[model samples]
Target: MLSLRPGSSGSLAPESSGAVIHPSAKCLIKRSIDILGALVGLVLLGLVAGPIAIAIRLDSPGPIFYAQTRYGLKGKPFTIWKFRSMVQNADLLKQTVSNQAQGLIFKNENDPRITRVGRVLRKTSLDEFPQFWNVLRGDMSLVGTRPPTEDEVSHYSSHHWRRLDVKPGITGQWQISGRSAIRDFEEIVHLDLHYQDIWSPWYDLQVIVKTITILLDRRGAY
Candidate 1:
């Protein structure tokens, strides 16, 4: 299993993931762009949040948002927020259903826990709006790697933990490539670490552009 140690300030210490992810000037540029994009998203959220919340309430008996613990930069824990797209007891129901995906991840294309409104929220990616708050709060980047749940992290081999060297993202290569259709978890790690290796402001912009295209086309998204 991967090892992690908390920074003195209670954040992730730089060396926690067993590799030094050198901070670059381009990284700072990427951070600036993230802030701008997140601010716009939060403003948009203010307009759509009420309607989405009401729809969720009418379709399901659960909280408007689902906040789950996930590992962010350097395997640090953070709660990722999304519009509730599953039943209240969805987490508890995980083990009862056999996983349909490969390599330690649980995925079911037809998971019964999904709500009526949830299906729409997921396909159009509206369930991702709440994560703008996380981006604004600096818990995530606008583009990077996907965040993994603590349970998923717990099972990661040390090499797999390298993906956590950078901040997680609301959209990335994985989402744009195959999104929920991806089966092998290794494919995801490959793309994420590939991003880590070739990360640049231009690349991030490219990924963001492709992500918009994917959202509009609703390709491969659940």
Candidate 2:
């Protein structure tokens, strides 16, 4: 479980307390880029959302969108939106499935909870398109760390909280660095920290470009 003891500042400190690590967190230029990128993404989403919605409706019986709470910067909770890619009762049935990945995060590439349409959505990452709204709303960035669920963060070590210093992203080190293949949560934390250490507008741009290539090829996604 996480060390929730408050620091002198009355806020929980990361396992290894350190100064703020990401310049992107406070950069007005980075914020501007996020806004622009999110707008473009929303436009693209607008174009495809209809067909995707129809497909989901035909493929399963559930709402068109799925809204869930996710932890963001400093472990703040916010609603993250996605296209519904699972059965309506998937969350309720979570315990019925086994977690293939180790540590705080959970993953199961072959999880039976995923619908047939969900599989394609996960592979193509179309399921993530709705999160552009989160970026536009400032709950997320165009590039940063992956947003963690409450269950995952509940068990975080003090060091694990470091990844939450910046806003969560629709695409980041985890998405580009083998989403499902990299199952170990510690590796993900390493990638998240590495992203913060090396982040610059140029670096974010590179990651975004590489992400596009990966998405186009449908590589390393589900």
Candidate 3:
């Protein structure tokens, strides 16, 4: 078994201490895919996201972008970026509304804190566009498991950590399968493990196709 210790930066390091999984062929290929997608996504961002940013600014009094720490591959923490979709101090008000989700997840389908522009952004998944930058930075995949927040990760058992063995994604089985329709976090883990276990370029393609279809139909979006 490979043992790990905290590095000077406070992130986990393997016992080998020298070779990270940065040079493997699979890793390189995955990075290439991410880079290509991010480049193309940047074009779309230029065309669409600028107006969305303006609309968000006009509708709310907060930063246009929101970054939250999320657990990535092997439980490493990285900041996940999204368009600000809630009130300026939404985090401070999270406890004001009870979580409607099951397990460690939090959800409020009718969260009063959501702004008008924010509602449109979430419904269209436009709020997710900034994550292409995350893909560019090698912090996320185009398709994988949902990135869990630090608090969510804190509640994870050993079995629940399996989803973190691979990079977190912009969209995954969780999004295409049901998204807000999914109430149980265990079911999300189940779908995520299934994707991780059966992952392939073809599987990624299928999920992307499904995601595009769902987005066009605006199905199961909160």
TM-score of each: 0.92, 0.92, 0.89
Clashes of 1: 0
Per-residue C-alpha lDDT of model 1 across residues 3-40, encoded as one tens digit per residue = 54565445443343554663522377988999999999
RMSD of 3: 3.7
In lDDT terms, which candidate is top?
A: 2
- Over the full model, what C-alpha lDDT does candidate 1 score relative to the true structure? 0.84
Instruction: Give the TM-score (vs. native) of candidate 3.
Output: 0.89
Q: Write model 2 residue lDDT over 105-186, tens digit each, in one string.
A: 7788888989999999999999999999999999899899989987777678777888988889988998888878898999
Best first by lDDT, ranked: 2, 1, 3
Whole-model alpha-carbon lDDT for candidate 3: 0.81
lDDT of 3 by residue, 1-222 (tens): 245555454544344444333221156666777789888887898899789889988998889899898877766778899999899999999989878888989988999999999999899998999999998998888988898886776666666767777788899989988999998999999998888777777778788889989999999886
Q: What is the C-alpha lDDT of each candidate?
A: 0.84, 0.86, 0.81
| Lowest-sum lDDT 10-residue window in model 3 | 16-25
Cα deviation of 173, candidate 2, in Å: 1.3
